[model samples]
Target chain A: MEGKIRQILKDHGRLSIDTTKLAVDSDLYQAGMTSHASVNVMLALEGVFDIEFPDRMLKRSVFESISAIQTAISELKTN
Target chain B: MTTEFSSKILYDDLVKFGHIIPVGVPGIFGRGAVFEEILNRFDAAVSRLAASDHATKVHFPPCINRQVLQKSMYIDSFPQLSGTVFSFTGNDAAHRELSSRLKDDKPWGDLQTMTDCCLTPAACYPVYPTFTGTLPPNGALVDVQNWVFRHEPSEEPTRMQAFRVHEYVRLGTTDVVVAWRDLWLQRGLKILLSLGLPVKAELASDPFFGRGGRMLAANQREQKLKFEVVCPVISSEKPTALCSFNYHQDKFGTIFNIKTSTGETADTACLGFGLERIVMALLKTHGMDPDSWPKPVREVLWA
Candidate 1:
């Protein structure tokens, strides 16, 4: 699953995204990801994990890392 | 309009953060390394607790949808104040597009999209859509910041194509919005005066949309969509707007469908701090020496 998310992170060239040595559970903003890049990352997650993001979660806090992205996908699945 | 804060406060903090760039565009006469230094102090001197009940350490860029912007009626309301995000789109004519970039031709694409994801005329537009369609149970407070863009064609050092803005917005009942606005308006005054920045509170209006915008602006003057915290940034009498307290009275909620748990339409207010203007304000008040600011404000910066 992490492998799948990593590929999606790099898939978009419109915004620069890094997929190497990914850290999970940390705030993406502190890690220096711009808000614009976060939106692209959210679009990538929908493809990798087969989950869609509510407009509310299109923030830095939600896409903190591969694990947080995966966890959000999991939470949305149950609902 | 100019600023009131000392330029020194902005220099040592975020400008030193190493990522900010002092890029230039045509007619954007004020943005050079010089203006960047002044704004740096303003951005750095921000206080987390005093600005509002909320603060988000991260900055949210205003990239909202064209549809959302149209629905908000920003195009019709503040046409003079709007900036749309633009990009080249004739992908099949890729070589032609490249030629336009290289030799400067009539690039087919214009307007930064029919509008930006959000036409960020003010700093607080992002939050309204975030909670649209439903209200927070206990009421949610968001401290948001952005490098807000405005279409003022001014060459003054204080007015620029873009500037940093800090806002703490409250979403809830009419009472919550008013209480938060009233409370912060008081705090905003104290902080400016503490820094010895001469400021005044007066009814204000958004630079409305178009031909009809004048009518709206006049009505706004009557009702006051805005209140400016003016201080001497450029000159003593030419006070810069350091902060603004706005009461939208459900105009945004009504448009965005921001409602409470009770399914009642919500009211909203924002407490905004113009970062560059504040730095300018401090520069106007305290001069450019970090050594000269009041012991308290200076200590806060050093701390």
Candidate 2:
């Protein structure tokens, strides 16, 4: 799962950027990310984990950063 | 056999344009395989262009409260085109019996309720009644996507019973209304061009409901208060309108009592894009291969 997330960052060209700068709750929307990229991230994660993201979690806040996405992935796997 | 691509005549025809059918939507209102790919691309384009913080993305419904429109005499503005849904006694029983008759293709049910609260022909009516009694603090700007309905029956996908609308809307001061539409107009074109869709923009007029509607339509054509982004879908002479930027100078504001901070009636302008028409254009423009689309176009939209 971590590897897939890493690949997402790579494909999105956001891999090399330091994640240390992003705040967990800080909106990725305001962080200069495109919604299209966020959708790609969701699709990539869904493909990797083999789970459909629930309609409720499709908000932009769901993919705020590597940590947020990882948290969502864990919750999905557990359920 | 279920083809790997689930290809259909209807689906392929729409695919020639880049439409994706949304899942779980009912037909007679756009539930079909053809819209699948086209919607997907349109979603991608919308996410890219409508991503700005200022654009408040919204989903509007077509069923406007008749009382709300009636107060403003919107009913008087164009009665023929205005659709309302109403409930009448025994209409349902009569309708069921009629459907049984439709075993031979006959009409069913009480259509009286269909007269009371109408499905909005355009996307903005419901918003006026429920949400926008007053404008935003800095004046409201919204991006509303809706499924619109029209009674016009045609075999053409362009004139189907239902279709999706992507609109960037604004309601506020006159300046705000004009600015919001101008910004969306520019953005609308950029997104269309990015998809490699060829289009022409022309001034458009209100789709007035009756014979007088013709004069209104002609007047609109003359004044150019509205601009239509069209492509060669049905034909060059009657190109499908992929997008329309209209300046409804306080028309809705006055009717819905939508007001600016100063308590004066404000105007609204909406930039609406016909999702199906765009896909039609894309089908006409790029052929069936997204992978081979021009690099710049593909880069902006795909990744």
Candidate 3:
């Protein structure tokens, strides 16, 4: 799940640094991912995981870090 | 906080004094002659302050191309606030059905089809498409004034559904755009001060919609990308934003394909003065009668 999240970030995050080198808890927004880029990342994650993020889960913290995104996707998958 | 009763009272007073004519809408109204005169004078004062900038003046209709709006991704962030133009593009039978529904006071919105245009949400929106090519070595500065629309219906007199914005747009490098926005924050505050407004500049964010929008707004604020000059128009506790300064860091440049003379994606910044809101602030601060306004304020506006 972590590897997949990193791959998705690389493909859509538009971050200044390599996603693989960054810590799972690192702030994606601080890594230079803009709000517009974050929207694209959310859409791409939804497509990859084949899951819909409910309105309650659509927040900055859910996509703030690799681990946060992994946890969000895991929760949705289990549900 | 401005209560509903207070909002209504202010609205009623403006109407009673012939400042705004209520057209039976919560946020839509017709400006009276006195209101128009004051609004125009304030707009002129702003223009005078920006005269040294020598921005290229351009005017656009209230509606913008639908495709441009879609590409700008406004709907993704502010779907609730967007207003799309719809028209009755039906055949004779459909038109008759629509007319019958309207005459019968039934729901008729289903008959209208979305057009290729949407109401302009911001005065600077139409200016981006015009700068799609490339900027000169010195970059580009543009002056535009247009009626912008938002879907939020409110009883607050300052929150108009349709209002005018005197906007200045700057497109250039990152440093240039950021500096211009910062400069305008002070300049806008100074202009309001000259009018005797008790205004203050503070970091602000757009009213993005929904849960995702909360994150967007936080990110925008964290980056210090937006600021506003606010004053107590209707509520002393909650001031109204009369002018906004925004720094769009290569967002418009990337979407509009705007390139700098140095061959990099251009950065963009814009400052918009809410003309109607300013006039409302003026009325609230100096009573309804302009003649009774402080002498210095009158001179700055009327002179």
Candidate 4:
């Protein structure tokens, strides 16, 4: 799941750095992921996980890092 | 009023007619005499609308207090577009070093410190912070004109970084504010039509940030909380938004501690006109020569 999430970030996050080198807890925005790119990442995550993020989870913080996104995906799965 | 010029021609005409003076910047420019005349006429038209309405007219500069901006949560949504004011506060040695670097064409801006204020993002933003504790009998209607800034840099002349917005804000009950917004939406369309530009009011959304912003934008449209008077100045296929009508349901009231006469949080609505965009639309619609414009259109603007 982590590797797949990292691959999704690599595909859509538009980060300046290599996502593989960054830790799961690293800040995506600080790594140069723009708001537009973040939206693309969210859409890609939805497609990959086969789950839709609720309106409440659609915030900058939720897409802040791989850990944050994984946490959100876990929550969505639980529900 | 029936000209078939592209955005490029319209942009050149603005420069040729001395309506707009383009500086080196992509989105920042200096307005000339004719542009100022059109701006004043637009202001007069707005004044005529509020003649008997007795709205409190207020004016603000291009910058806002940083606290107000943070309280308004502008940074949360548009952190990329917000331009905080910064000033140089270097010591003597630092200043000498900066001067030396300047001689060598080095980047000296990094020595500047962020100030307590930032450029104003919206015309109505400063108004909310002023309403600390409020609840008049009928609520408040404010007429505000302010120079606003956004960091979107584009070669398109219509999308300006620094521009003026003339707005009328109504803070009251939801019913009254929504009604007022609807009324202005119609009136705005009529006013633009009178100026001889083909315009239409359509449901729209603020450019919110991230994936969440998409949901928020969808919600805003679903709730019919935002609309724009768009014109085909830049692109005929996708018209540009000249004016916007937003119905912020108790967001500002809750943040600013504003209450209605009945002690409920007051809902707020505003209609904003992008003064430059309107002028651009008029020029695009009426051809480069102002005198060659249709008689009735000239009368509506000049008279």
Among these predictions, the greatest lDDT belongs to 3
DockQ of predictions, in order shown: 0.01, 0.01, 0.31, 0.11
lDDT of 3 at A64: 92
Q: Which stretches of candidate 1 lie over 4 Å from their true place?
A: A1-79, B1-46, B51-59, B91-94, B97-119, B294-297
TM-score of model number 2: 0.64
How would you encode candidate 2's per-residue C-alpha lDDT over B1-303 as one tens digit per residue?
A: 111222244454553444544333322433345445556667667767667646766675667666776765556556755556765455677767766777876654443345556676677656666545666667776767777776665555566557778776677888877877777778777777666666767677666654334434554554456988776655656767888899877667755778888888888787787876676566556654556657876666556
- Per-model TM-score on C-alpha atoms: 0.64, 0.64, 0.88, 0.79
How far is B296's C-alpha from truth in model 2 (Å)?
Answer: 3.2
Q: What is the per-residue lDDT of model 4 for residues B3-90, given as tens digits with 9 covering 90 to 100?
A: 5646677677788888889898988999998778878898788778667879898888888899887876688778878989999898
- Judging by TM-score against the true structure, name the best candidate: 3
Could you tell me the TM-score of candidate 1? Answer: 0.64
Model 1 chain A worst lDDT run, 10 consecutive residues: A12-21
On residues B166-226, what C-alpha lDDT tens digit does candidate 1 reach at each position?
8778788988778878888887787677667678787787775533344345544655657
The list of candidate 2 runs beyond 4 A from truth reads A1-79, B1-35, B69-82, B86-88, B91-116, B131-133
DockQ of 2: 0.01
**10 residues in a row with least lDDT, candidate 4 chain B:** B1-10
Error of 1 at A18 (Å): 58
lDDT of 3 at B254: 83
lDDT of 1 by residue, A1-79 (tens): 7777667665641223366655655455455453334555666677666777764554444566668877878889888
- The numbered model that scores best in DockQ is 3
